[model samples]
Target: MIRWGTSAWLGSLAVGAILAATVTFAGVEDRADAGRALPAPTLSTPPTSSPRPTTTTTTAPPDPCGAVAAGMSSRARLAQLVMVGVDPRGADDAVDQVRAEQIGGIFIGGDAVGLLSGGALGSVHATASLPLTVAVDDEGGRVQRVDQLDGELPSAREMVARYSPDEVRALAHKRGAALRARGVTMDLAPVVDTSDQPGRTVIGDRSFSPDPRVATAYALAFSDGLRAAGVAPVLKHFPGHGNTTGDSHLGSVRSPALDALRGTDLVPYRSLPEFGDVTVMVGHIDVPGLTDGRPASVSPAAYALLRGEFAFAGPVMTDDLGAMRAVTDLYDLPDAVLHALAAGADVALWSSGGRTGEVLTRLENAVASGELPQARVDEALRRVLHAKQVC
Candidate 1:
């Protein structure tokens, strides 16, 4: 990337420096002749000129993801930190978008069966040189993506009530296998939030049980089932969206104080031995003392709570930044994305796609202004790439 003009300018500067040094020495000699006797300049032969032992600088080759990343522009690197939504029916559009932005992943929303049917996703992967995360809300019951194709699954609550944890895991395994068959790599499922909300309420039947221990067991079983099926499961709405004041899709939502969450809502996230190879989605709920009354999605303290207290080393994602009222009502799309990624989220998810160019431009500016450090971006990028097992 070095320009020819820059090299020429450097050469001229080097030559000028040599001339200036010679003239300065000449002036010194003249001054000595006119004013006082000058000692002969030390002429000791330059000590053995040890010829620098023919050193060789060997650069280690880039790792798998690093090799691809090395050739990418800064903007492209930033783009890969975002996961945008694409229509399930628009396989061609999805392919074109991925080719254009080289984004980290894609979320397929709605009930459209076109892209998820008949090997339609193959077209998108055919041209993608990098590993692509194809995610969907396949939690089953109230929220199911491939139920129409693979047969509907019971609600989380219903599954817990009717079947043992092991049986539930088996059901999830089957569902996970079906989703993987449709080319989906990630499932936004097994709500870990412990809530007593009505079955039809926001988190509702999506939750396994109100007891934190029960919720944790069922959630872990579901996650294991997905992992067994080769699809990464995302444990979502962290900090407990189950009992929040309201739905984030409508507007602001507040969670219980952090202290209260430690016993109930946050119980399922005890860091266990590990969350395994999975991603945790931070929700947009406003936590009283931890998040400064702002949504956790854009709060540094909130992400810190997860990374610090929970000991979660896997990738983190933001809940629907594009369509959620909790974010949209507060900030514009581009700013929300910048804030999310800056706050420590590995991938900023905006399930209502588009505005990628605008958001990425703002992120580029954020990096330049030091609002979003390059080190943070690189860390997040590596986490995302690792989640895809690309490197």
Candidate 2:
């Protein structure tokens, strides 16, 4: 639903231009420092998800990058941190961009996935050297992207009402198998938000339950199913989006104070680490206690809470940066991307395409001018590359 020529669009372009000019002028003195060699990346392979019961576990292989990341150019390494959306019908263009940009991942909307067959997905995969993180929002029910290809599945609410957590796990396994067959590596699903309000429009039926304990059980079950099927599950809208009444796709939303969130909203995230290496998607909600007023995705304090308070060490990604009005309305696209990285996001998900190259250029400029540290970019790239290898 994001369109060009809106007021927000104009504002973004204006801000981006100003930042570009400023960075270019400041970059002259720091360019040499930016080009200095990075230290060898040390990454531990996270445990892969198991298809068995929650109690079963398996160790993943060694780091996939090895020496490949060290040999990559700054631009190539930066490319690994951006995940962009592409049109399924325009497979040729998407493939061309994959080669041209060396981007880390490609994602398709629910409606677009219906139009793309398995062969089409494979063709896209064939274009990449590294395995592209082919992701889809196949959460089932009202949010599934490939229901046409995978068959219609019940919503989380319906499944929770009619089935046990074990049953939901089995259903997720089936869904994950279908996605893997079509070349999908990641499933952006199994929303763990615990919202009890019947009038919660943004996440009403999407959440498993208002009870945090119940939601956690179903989420872990779903995660087990995905891992069993060889697909990585991305636990989404982190710091919880259930309490908010506003939709981030349209505008900004606010959440409770950190203390209040800890008791209710953060329960699922705190307990999820027992499942192992699950990617957390930071939402665009403003939690006054944690961030003062900035949206969680772009707030350094918010991510600090995730790392320090919650002790989560897995990959952290931003919710759709280009599509969400909470971001698009507040800052230029490039600024949003920089802020997300500065705030400790490992990946910046841009569900709307056509701006990949521009964002990459801006990132290069930021690093050159020392507005963003090169080490920060390297850290984000390391986590992203590691996730692509193991997850």
Error of 1 at 164 (Å): 0.9
**lDDT (tens digit, per residue) of candidate 1 on 16-86:** 11111111111112333577655555677443223333434445543656654666789988977888899
Residues forming the 10-long window of minimal summed lDDT in candidate 2: 15-24
> What's model 1's TM-score?
0.83
lDDT of 2 by residue, 1-391 (tens): 1110112213322211111111111212334447676555457743232234333233444443534566678788788888888886647767887988878888787375532574776667666655677777877777887777769878777788999989988999998888777777788888998886663378888888889898889889998888778788889787879887588889989887778888777898888666675788999999877777788999998788888878887788899999899999998888899889988998888888778888999988988999889888877876775555421
Off by over 4 Å in 1: 1-68, 272-274
TM-score of each: 0.83, 0.81
Clashing pairs in 2: 51-228, 110-145
Per-candidate total of colliding backbone pairs: 0, 2
Residue 265 CA displacement from its true place in model 1, Å: 1.4
